[model samples]
Target chain A: MKKLSLAEHSVRELNSALHDPQAMDGGTEWYVSDPDGRHALACGLNDELQVTIDGHAGYYCAGMNQHATVVVNGTVGVGVAENMMSGLVRVRGNASQSAGATGHGGLLVIEGNASARCGISMKGIDIVVGGDVGHMSAFMGQAGRLVVCGDAGEAFGDSIYEARLYVRGQVESLGADCIEKPMRDEHREELRGLLAHAGMDFDPSEFRRYGSARELYNFHVDNAGIEQGDSHE
Target chain B: MCGIVGLYLKDPSLEPRLGELFEPMLLAMADRGPDSAGFAIYGDEVPSDQLKFTLQSAEPGYDWEGLVTAMERDLGGQLDWFRNATAVVIKTDSGEERVREWLAGNAPAVSLMSVGHSIEILKGVGHPRLVADRFSLSGMQGSHIIGHTRMATESAVSMEGSHPFTTGLDLCLVHNGSLSNHNRLRLELERQGMTFETENDSEVAAAYLTWKLREGETLTQALESAIQDLDGFYTFTIGTRDGFAVLRDPIACKPAVLAETDAYVAMASEYRALARLPGISGARVWEPEPGRVYVWENAQQASEETGT
Candidate 1:
């Protein structure tokens, strides 16, 4: 296995080097020394490459990613794996704002607390935050699963769509268009799989699932007045 | 574009220490304006004792060196270059009188604007971190700071092209919203020989305000002029060396949230940004009224100057 040291290379050059087919074939494992705790490491990858960031990262690390496995050994900044379409990103420490925002596919597993607006506008990404989440988590979320093992702040799952939210601890409040739902056997099994993959051993039965009630998805002519009431209510 | 942030303590406010924390706060808005970031820190340094000047030529190759040399000969050792650029900055000890004399001597080709000391500016390119690291921004101490985060939709990003542009030494400006009538204003400014550095709408606002100030309009008068002339969904925060002002276009397409406390005043592109400040916990926060020009000297002197 070859090793590519990003100690000297800029973020652009480091990502570009990883994309080269020849560099990938050499079994190169990239690492950074003067990581400078920058953001957007290994972002937008589409190949089956394996990348590892050795230290703390700033915002949007591994964002909009696909077909790659990226691992961060330290804390991550905002929007990790945002809009991801495929592959996996594993964070070993706390994540900042809007982790996994608008991700359409793939999985993001954070081992620590996530800041406000986690999984906002998420499409299909499966996000597992091992610790607490700040306010406005899952805001305007469209689809996917947000699994939280700890407490949630205010406005959890506001304006949720088809996305599922599973929380083991207390929830401050639900946002607009969000309500609790029964976690069926299939959900339990899926949650189990995610836990095992993320190396967590929590019980799925203790978690609660929240999703959209489908009350605000489409406009109805017959219910126009009711919709207006809901708008202000 | 780049992200910009600033804080100010208008008079009668005792939280003058808030100006010391400008760097860390502005760093958070980096994503909005990653192309370049800078702040004009207005400290206890009073503008009354100094002359503040800013210059831009209507023609590109106007003789900046010749103008500087002549101003130096006139003002002598009383002159200080607070900031030197392809344009220029020269402070005269004679205050506004020396500045007016110098301006009166220059040709119409050498467009210049000067005012009482009250403005400061900081700028550079790249992400907020890059700009902060390059400038060691966190250490700055000032009475206020204003900033912008750029996405570069309209102009090629560069240090000169970046914003928080000054009309005079005392007044600095930052913008977030886009202007629709930029082309028309750009043409007008161009025909007037305001050699524009970039195709950014923000630049038009800067030049237009400068032109208005050159025409002897006060800060408030110049802003009212902007409300009349500039079109589009724009929001801007203007910081003079002594005071600060906010304006939103009639449509209010952009987001700007302000939080005021006895200690300091803060504003940002989103409520989330303003809510995240450290000492501003529980600060009374609200979005600026659409189409209104909100002015403040600090926490104590805030008022709605205009509205729809």
Candidate 2:
């Protein structure tokens, strides 16, 4: 096990050491203490290493991970696990905005509430929140799945595309072109697997699925005519 | 982008260390806004019968004592004054309107930063750390304080463009986002006889709040109207004589984190600002909801209220 204290080491030194093959080959397990809400800790990891942050982190913690698993014992700031290609990042406490934003592939589990724009613009990430999510949770999400075990804030998924959303609690409102869909047996099975993997005990049958209505995939001719008329005027 | 930080002590025992605890929070946001910085401290309030005014001058070695002597001669009262860098704080029994009229006529080079019993605002065009040090912010003793670090998105990087703008007596505001409809609102507010000191959008916000309060709206009511009347992205931390309040726009594109312990309630643009506070590890931390008003007041008894 490798131990790192953020109090004594800069984030650059810690990230550089994590990136070095010689330094990482000695141990796959890493411990980071006293993160003190510093930004961009343990980012851009490609190897299959297990890293744990013992305290709260600042923005973009563990971002762009390819094959590593990172866990934060406390809350995280904005854009945690943003644009990750693969691997897992779990947060034991609440998360600020845009968690798992624009990620291509990853499994990000937040055991506490996630604020606005969780899974925003995500491509293939799977996010499971143990608590409520703020407004615009999955705004413009191109593809992937977001599971919320607690209540969701306003505009659950705004202008979404192809992404599936499962919530076990009440949704304040849904965004444009997003509607609640039927919960099929396959979806239940998928939720079951995700919940089991994330170590959540909730039953899959209690969740409802939401997805895009596909109405915004193309521009309407009526709107084009209206635009032409307005331009002529 | 800009950064806003506020600390309101619920436990009166922490009042003496208010500036010491808030300095790091403001410093942590240096990267967010490197152009200019300011802070408003609610401390050492004068008696209710008197008022305190914070004034600043850009000229080097400005005659603050001479200005105080002139004010004393005109207002017919002894004015106690102190200086911090280029700024001077004066306590007087004169009327606010009379003092303004006197300053406008006699002190053309000086600018009124704030006028209240408790609030004293100090801001300048420089890094936040330097501004904090210049004002001896870490040594300030207060019940609450709000600070802003400006990146100069909608306004120039001048002393007048900096934040912690005074809204009314014992009230100041620091903002973290730009206002889009400030020009129109400024016109409307000017028509209502509200004066403005800068072209900065945040000053417009402060003036708007002042107008609302003058029209008999409560602070929460004024902020609720701000959500409708103001157009832009903003996360504002307002420091009042009693305590402080936090509000975010409906879209909430700008980030705001709030943490509360038994001792104090802290709001910062990011968690990094609050991470170093004592008992922060045990604080009940969360994000303030969008378009909601969260106020922590220490009047008579400490109380927190959330309103939408």
Candidate 3:
């Protein structure tokens, strides 16, 4: 067990200390204080360490993480746990835009709302937001599971591909190529596991599943007007 | 990349220190926008019967004195003036159309930054710090303020290209991202008799909002309509005499953060800009949801609203 105050050491110093395998010889449990919404804190930790951030943090706080379990007690700014390969990152408070953006592997959970672009371009990550997830979430997602306990914003999961989206509340609008799918036995079982891992108590049967329609995966030249946005291609 | 910061104080005790609190928030995003920067502060309310006009000139050494004297003589009205670095605030008991027409017909060399009872806009090219210092922004006072640092993704890097564009009577808008269909929207707005001040994409948005308000749309309705009407990546923070608001495009690619305490509500491009605010640690901070209109109005004005 260890304790480091961000007031005494810069975020870089604390991260470097966490990165050094020898420096963490006493134990893998470290507590960080006075984060005060600074960027890149507790990022890129690979070992099976437990990192507890005492306060708010800024962009990419637990980015590119693997194996480590990081907890933020307060709100987090943009791109929290961005591009994580594997790990568990938890925010006890709300998360800003693009939470867990483009992460390949990991589980990121927010106890409060997540703003726009939550889980965007996620290759393989399970994201659970206790509150609403904002618009354009899961945009162009390749593969993953995004579970929302509250409303999902406009154009949720636009231009999607092979990712699963589950929402318990209303969805403002679904993006192109993303369509609501029936939550079957397999999806319920998988969602049950995800909710359990995130320590959320919601019933899997309460949610509805959404995923790619697979219509745009192999576009036929004959099918015109598929790209229907105002922008000219 | 661009940076936007807004401060709306619910606690009157903090009004006098608006500039000192807002200076760092603007400069923190210096890297986000290197081309130009600007801000609109709601301060120095004129007499209720009077109109205030913030006037500026392209030439630094332009004879503001001679022009003011001549205008006073010609308009046959007493005009009190306060000169800051970026522009001059002129308070006069004059009609809005008459003043604008007078300025247009007489003082073509002078440009109007804003025309309201209590707003002053100051902006210029360079670092936010330099711009703030040049205008002595840290010494001003107001109920609310909104600022922008531009990266010049579209228009040329001139003062007109800078943000916190003022279009309506006392309203101003600062943007974070570029609009994709501004050309078409601009044309449509121009045909409706809304004039433009610059080729900047953001100006079109400002004009659009002003036009909507003129057409009897409430501020909330105008912002909601923006999400449907405008196409592009954008997050707009609009400032009015008694209110301030935040809105984003449906697919909110632009970044914005908000924090609120008993004393104030603050918004910025990132949390770091808001980190230094007083009593922020205990404030309720959250990311503003996309396609939602978040507005903070003066209590008196808010209570005056008749219906939803």
Candidate 4:
């Protein structure tokens, strides 16, 4: 395992080394220390490397990852793993807002609570939260699955599409066009697979599913004033 | 975007080093808001008979001593004063209304920054580090401090546009978001007899709180009212004589992180500002919920009804 100290190397230098093909040829495992809540640490990685951050990280930590497995032992600021295409980012502590935002494909596991807008506008990324998620989690999510072992905050899955949500605890409120559906065998199997992947040991039957109501998929003339003339006929 | 940082010392031992600890927190947020900076520090309360006024002048080398002498002679009372760069903190036995009138009439260039028994506000237009250094913020001793670094999205870059606006006696507020309905609200507040020092939306928010408090509402209740009346996104950290409170809009578009240790309670726009605090790794760190008021007061000043 190769060790890097953020106190000695700037974030740019460390990421440059991580991004260099020659420098990464001999090492697949890396350890970083003294993160000290610095922004953009080890971001934009494209290799299949396993990196462990020993301390807290600032905003956009491990963002835009392609094939790397990044682990944060401490908390993270806003937008951790934002816009990722593929990879695994695990936050050992709580995460600020917009975690896994707009990720097309990947797996993001937050061992602690995630603040607002977690998995917002996600395309295909799978997110599993061990604790509660704040307001507007998964807002306008397009695809993928989100599992919350703990309670979900206000407006869970607002204006969502295709993305599936499973919550074991209470949801404060549902957003516009979002409603809960019955959990079937297939959903339970999916939840079981996600929980197993996230290293959680909860009963799949204890969760409820939520998704879009499909009412917003088409434009209705009755909702607009253009249909008022037709109503006279 | 702007940055807001606040430190409320729960342990008395950290009082003397408050400024030393807070300077780095403010500097950490310099990138968020580089236009201007300001802070309100609650420290060294005067006797009940005296009131402390924090005054500022646009001129860096204003004649504070002569103004103090003139005020003492005109008000017929002895006044104690301390000067820090362009700002001055004066403790006088005069009434709030009389002192405000005297300053308005006698020293038009000198603006009243705050009026309270313990709060002293200092702000200027410049980089946060330079503003902090000009006011010797690193040497200030206080029980609690609220600071803001402004990027000037809603208003021009000026001293008056800076944050930590005085809400009432020993009460101040620092905001991290914009208010949409400030113009209409400002006019309404003016009709109701509330005066404003700037066209900044944040000042309207401060005045709105001052109005609510004047109408017999507690700080929490006033913030609860703000959730209904105020429009737009915001994460506000308000400093009171006893402690400080934090509130965010229901949508919570603005970011706010809160960490509490046995020694202090710290709130900032981001977690990086709170990273350098002592024992922060073990502190109970969490994000303040949307539209909820979170207040932390000094243990000695905390009453039964104000228990968190």
Best by DockQ: 2
Task: Quote each prediction's TM-score.
Answer: 0.53, 0.94, 0.88, 0.94
Question: Model 1, range A116-171, lDDT digits (tens) per residue?
Answer: 78899999999998998877899988888899999997789987778889999999
Residue B201: error of model 3 in Å?
1.7
After superposing all C-alphas onto the true structure, candidate 4 shows an RMSD in angstroms of 3.6
lDDT at residue B2 of model 1 (Cα atoms): 37
Write one digit per residue (lDDT tens) for candidate 2, span A52-128: 99999999999999899999999999999999999999999999999999999979999999999999998989999
- lDDT string for model 3 (B173-234, tens) is 99999998999999999999998988889999999999999999888778877887898999
User: After superposing candidate 4, which stretches have Cα over 4 Å from the reference?
Assistant: A218-233, B300-308
The residue-level lDDT of candidate 3 at B249 comes to 68
Off by over 4 Å in 3: A1-11, A139-144, A154-165, A171-190, A209-233, B58-62, B97-107, B300-308
lDDT of 2 by residue, B1-308 (tens): 88999988888889889999999999999999999999999889899889999999999689888899889988987578899998999999997999999999999889999999899999999999899998899888988889998898887789998998885788788888888999999999999998888888988998888899899987778888888898999999987788678889988889999998888889999998998899999999898888887766663223333344
In candidate 3, residue B58 scores what lDDT? 74
**CA lDDT for candidate 3:** 0.87
Task: Give the Cα error of residue A152 in candidate 3, in Å.
Answer: 3.3
Clashes of 4: 0
Candidate 2 fraction of reference contacts recovered = 0.67
Candidate 1 C-alpha lDDT tens digits along B77-113:
5766643333355666765656665676665554453
